[model samples]
Target: MANGVLRPGAVFAGYRIERVLGVGGMGTVYLAAHPRLPRQIALKLLHQNLTSDDYVRSRFELEAEHAARLEHPNVVAVEDRGRDGGQLWIAMRYVAGIDAEKLLSEGPLEPARAVYIITETAEALDYAHELGVLHRDVKPANILLERRGSNRRERVLLADFGIAKALEETTQLTSSGMMVASLPYAAPEAFDNLDPDPRMDVYALGCTLFRLLTGRQPYPGSTLPQLWYGHAQAPIPQPSAVRDGLPVGFDDVILRALAKKPNDRFRSCGELADAAVAALTPVSQLVVPPEPEPQAAPAPEEPTTVEVRTRPVATTPPPSPKERDARLAIASVTTRLSAVQTRAERLEPAFASLKSEFSAQCSADLISNERISSAEIVEAETILTSAVEALDRGDAERALELTRAVRAHLSTAERNVDAVTGRLALLRAVRANPKAKVAEVRFKVHDAQMLALNHGTADQWQAEFDAQLERIDRIAAELSGRHPDYWAYITGLDDVKSHISALVQRMKRERRLR
Candidate 1:
């Protein structure tokens, strides 16, 4: 439903898709589970349209082959592999934590922390190398850190060896004809060599370490050729260059690993880990001193004294009835918003099914992601928390206004979540019956399209929906050429495409009126 993906309830090869973990260079990876097993796993599936590409399909198979041989605790384990309809998929061991990119977004990791993760990942790399598996794609997003366990230690897992094969083989291409990897993290030599080895991974790990320590990629290039020049010819920058007061020892370790020549880098993973332990060791923890007290302003050179004189002035009365009623209405809405937020927060821990439903119906939807900002939501929640504190301190007017502001923010998200539910339900139904009548399916698509437009999805979602439709059209073309038997399926795709296009045009008109 979300860009032609399987619904949460849809099962493929016995694994039920729960939610999307992320979209990767190769495909979308979803959190899934076995129908009878207690454990959850990750399901990596190729996009439905990309299934016909030989290069992409071969790369997927290569990933499966590469990952199946890796059995280390630090590397994500492959549980199963199969083809589901037009998509090829691999079920993997589920690591319950966010990726390094999400973590780094909050801020840079401390030297000690970054070193620990790097070391753990190095161990995984060493293990995979020993097994003759080459993971050329080593980046922050590929490195997953499991939630802290009872021991307060995190477990790290490396992911997506599939992309290592595909991107290195395929030149970046697009309608513009100059598209490149948004942030390619492969080693410098891999760009030309196209062969993987331990040293290649070591170089990538070094670059990943730089990002972890400083919260950004080493080279700030925006274009593919610029990035290529950066990796191949630009001088390697140290981690401490970006982060002040960081241990200087890291300069030696990082620079040597990022040396233009592979032979200049660390000879082995063991050697790299030994150097990291020293480079990452804390000479002293950074203890922030307390904020200084504000000093009173000094008196001017020419001292002036004001003469005390009481003057009669017209006095304003208290708020009139209309003003008072406006305040009361805001207060009432504030209370309602507070109750709704309470219910939402409760879903995080109090109810499992409802929490899952929200993630499925709202969080998993691509439209919701493009329309909403998670950071903004968090900020609004924090403001509401402060507003509640203001109420606790008996500042009724200030609390009422602040809470009302937060209510509007929450309402936007609440509306988005509610609006998608009906549309998504229809999408799920249509996928289940691809052979259904044109009129029957068109009705379902029409209903969903109307709901999307009413909820303001036309202008905001047209570009994304258009791209998805193009993919469907491509798939239809490929399918139609095969035989007469696929004509019905192509017709099904046509109905979906036509309905979506109508919705888009309707949205454009709506936007113009506004």
Candidate 2:
């Protein structure tokens, strides 16, 4: 444990260590095997000395808790975690992939491929935000891409949430006199330590997209202050400016994403992805053809007045039953779509309230969730616009279908907003009386653990333990971050954590006996 590196073949905490996967400021990640299972995992061990620091330990644990809560296909899943000797360790899926930072050595990625990677990463960020988590540190090093296979689409995942924070959490885990987010990718607000928000991630991701597209950082500075100044004060750099033949539209997307004010940026990572996709449309397709010059009016021809005889209006035949039914269906769908739009409008107040409160409190995670709702509303509006266009074109069936889809999107958006507000209410209630909330959450964690242990096989119990840990961790973090004042809550979490360690140890012992 001298340098937090495990020698190959060394067995620790039931994992047979193979070799170092990577090394970083926090610790070293090793490719290791499960003690009783024939599978490998990426095990990360915090540097021994840092583990003794309360802040570092809390941040490391928070990373595991945050990443574990994000059940996203584009996000790395933390499978297990515990302390060994004096170092805290976590086990995660061992992705046979290369980090995006390293991949740059082969030169810039193809524009389409880079956008695809960013889209995937955006999905992971959006999912994390929906669950009230923030990947405070998003950079090329943390963006992982699986080794390519001829028959498979490339897989990209966002990893290393060591600096992540839960929604409305007050602890400044990202700040300990060390730059948690790499300087080049760090947002402007980060330098000022302004309350972190989802826009920070947006800014970082924008920088990342620039890197992948141009094979260089958006702002290259020779020193820390220079980089800080660039992000904080310099004009946003355009990807097209750095790389020849790059789409000009990318410039617009990056400029907005890396805007000086968060308000000027995309509301969520998904929106940024959507814009990036739009940028991929061919310039010719996006351009509007110029109007032809009006032909000169024909020289005044004699106005031959035709007789204006008014004949009796011809009676049109009554509509067929099928036509009448289609008209009725369109009316019904239109009414439903109107109702959906009204519902979304009504929910706007609550959503706005929660967003304002969280933003003022520097709760980036909740703000991001609010943005998710906002994005959903935007999407519903877009669909509604299309529905209107269909109606204009006399496509009643298409219009009806689009209306129904709009309703569904609005419903989903409302549900997401409701969820965010519900979580906010619960967190507020818990903060009202931390002592009592701690006891309640603690009892639940303990009860859940015992129930799992008493009723399942080792593997089942392990799975149960992980599920419960994520549930209770969210409660605990929302109630109070790993603040020293919340020692009781931390201790309760430790008890719940013990269940997993016990199961792992028992499994190893039983395997040896067999």
* Candidate maximizing TM-score: 2
Which residue pairs show collisions in model 1?
Answer: none
- Residue pairs with colliding backbones in model 2 are none
Candidate 2 residue lDDT tens string, 1-514: 4444568888889899888888875568899998878899989876665556443455456557646766778988888877765668888888898999999999998889899999999999977765546787788988888876889987998987644332112222233233444778878877665545577899889989999999998887856778878988898887866887776667657877888887667667977887687666655443222223444444554557864443454454554443433343344333434543454454556556544543334234445555666677788778767865665565667765775576556556655654555545544543455544444344434433443443344355656666756756665666444433233344455565465446544543564476
Per-candidate TM-score against the hidden true structure? 0.52, 0.57
Q: How much does candidate 2 score in TM-score?
A: 0.57
**What lDDT is obtained when candidate 2 is compared to the true structure?**
0.66
lDDT of 1 by residue, 69-116 (tens): 677888888877767656788888899998988999899997778888
Give me the displacement of residue 97 in model 2, in angstroms: 1.8
lDDT (CA) per prediction: 0.61, 0.66
